[model samples]
Target: MDLSMMIEAVVVLSSGLRLTLTLTILALATGFVISVPLAFVRAFARPALSLSVLAYTYVFRGTPMLVQLFLVYYGLGQIEAVRTSIFWVVLRDPFWCALLTFSLNSAAHTTEILCRGLQSVPKGMTEAAATLGLKRFQIARLVTFPIALRISLPAYGNEVVSMIKGSSLASTVTLLEVTGMARQMVSTTFAPYEIFIVAGAIYLLLTSVVVKAIRFLERHLATDGSRRQRRGSRLAPALPDAGVTTP
Candidate 1:
């Protein structure tokens, strides 16, 4: 690409990047905070007890987020009741609609990931906690959720990264996010290739930042203590053995 065109592309794409990153972080944070309790209920409660959470996760995960966004932004606008509702003031804009869709999308996947994490925890640990005089709620709060989070973090990291990419869908709803900006630049300059390449690069750069931050977080929250203790216990000789090395 020519230098002038490249510079123009970067300027436009950078502007879009700011909005993309902001929405991505806001959506993911909201999803993560909400998903834990949803997951807990899904994991431990009876089917009847957890019906709402289950249905919520099922509906969100099953549907395309683009469809959900459109339904919220465009579909809702068609409804007189929705227009009359207090929420209409906010939903009249596409930004909040995109935010709601992205947040709910991540929440569904996060709930599933955390549910798997909860299942991975051994039943013996819960029993032990109970024997130690821990109440049901106390055991769940103090032990289950933390352990489940640690176990599911890697998967959750992937979900978060996916969320960053998914935020591109926001443009479909008329939001001036990265993809929208790229399309606008293409239409204006008739240089689709240059504008798209630059916009794609901006998205790549933003996604890379997310991945690096998650890696830093994973390291900071590493469960070395439990793993090391488990390994040590395994390596320790259960009974005297001539072949065993002394440490």
Candidate 2:
């Protein structure tokens, strides 16, 4: 491997880092907002609502993300109605189309992960909140969402990482993200190995930061209160059973 070539590749790829990060961040943020409502509907809504949510998630999750990107960027333009509609202006731009596709794809997966978290919330916790005169929405807002979000953090973190890597597909739409720039360099230099290695390293670094952040948040928001419980247990006295007879 040529050291100079690798270093040069890194610098060139770094230029596209801004676009890559923008795609990843925007996709994940939009997906997160959309997922929450979809998750809520999937978990607690009527059968029709649940089925609709399920179908949406099913189709998006089942399909390849690359196909989704193509469909949004190229497929949408082929429709007569789309070409004439107000959305045509937005869809005509490859960047917006890529963003829209990525957001929807990420939202589908995030919704399912969140639904799993919601389902994992202990039933007793919600019941106790109800007993305290809280309405359904209040209980869900105060109890369910917080706990479920913590439960979902690890999975959501993975989703964020996935989106970061997946954003490389934006190059197919002329987005010129890191992978895009790498490909451009490779075309000129005919050196795929060094260029790709640099691109992969950048992705690894981004994912590592995401994993550490998620771990920190998980530790900070731990709901088990295990440390406090252990301390109290050690300090408290153990009393004899009231019903036990004297030996």
Candidate 3:
């Protein structure tokens, strides 16, 4: 491998990093917004509402994101209603289609993560809140969501990293993201090995940042737990064991 050529390839790929980050940020932000309500439905809503969200999550999670991107980008254009509607302007662009697909796919996975967290929240905690005269909404907002969010943080971080890697699929729809730029550079330079390694390194760096950030957040939250345990230990009295007398 020529070191100079590899450096050039890295430079070119860096130019596309903005688009890559754009897709990842927008998709994750939209997905988080969408997942909150759906997760609530899955965790606490009525059967009818929960089942609808379950079906949505099942289909999106079951299918490949690439196929979903294709359907949104190409299939939508084929429909008469889509062609004539105001949304046509948005759907006509590859960027928006990719965003829509990525957002929906991320939302599906995020819903499952958050739903599991919500379900894992101890029933006694909420009951105790109610015993203190907290309203349903107040209990959920104050007691349930805070605990569930802490439980889900690690999984949500994984989802963010996955979306960062998955954003490469945006290349298929003609968006020149990092992987897309690398593919273009390889086609021109006829050196796929060097170009792809650089691309992989960039993704690795991005995921490392995400992992470290999540770990920091986890440790930050753990401090509170440690303090509570210490406080409880200080106030609680020690118990004595009965000694047996032998004849």
Model 2 agreement with the true structure over 68-115: per-residue lDDT tens digits: 999898898889999999999999998899899999999999999999
Q: Which stretches of candidate 1 lie over 4 Å from their true place?
A: 226-247
The residue-by-residue lDDT of candidate 3 on 1-247, one tens digit each, is: 7888889988999999999999999999999999988899999999999999999999999999999999999999999999999999999999999999999999999999999999999999999999999999899889998899999999999999999999999999989999999988988999998899899999999999999999999999999899999999999997655685556
Residue 139, candidate 2: Cα error in Å is: 1.1
lDDT of each residue in 127-215, candidate 1, tens digit only:
99999999999999998888888889889889977888899898888888889988888888899887888877877887788788878
Per lDDT, the best of the predicted structures is: 3
TM-score of each: 0.86, 0.91, 0.92
Model 1 residue 26 CA deviation in Å = 1.2
The best-first sequence of candidates by TM-score reads: 3, 2, 1
lDDT of 2: 0.94
Clashing pairs in 2: none
User: Whole-model lDDT, candidate 1?
Assistant: 0.87
Colliding residue pairs in candidate 3: none
> Deviation in angstroms for 53 in model 2?
0.6
Cα lDDT listed for each candidate: 0.87, 0.94, 0.95
TM-score-wise, the better of 2 and 3 is 3
Count of backbone clashes for each model? 0, 0, 0
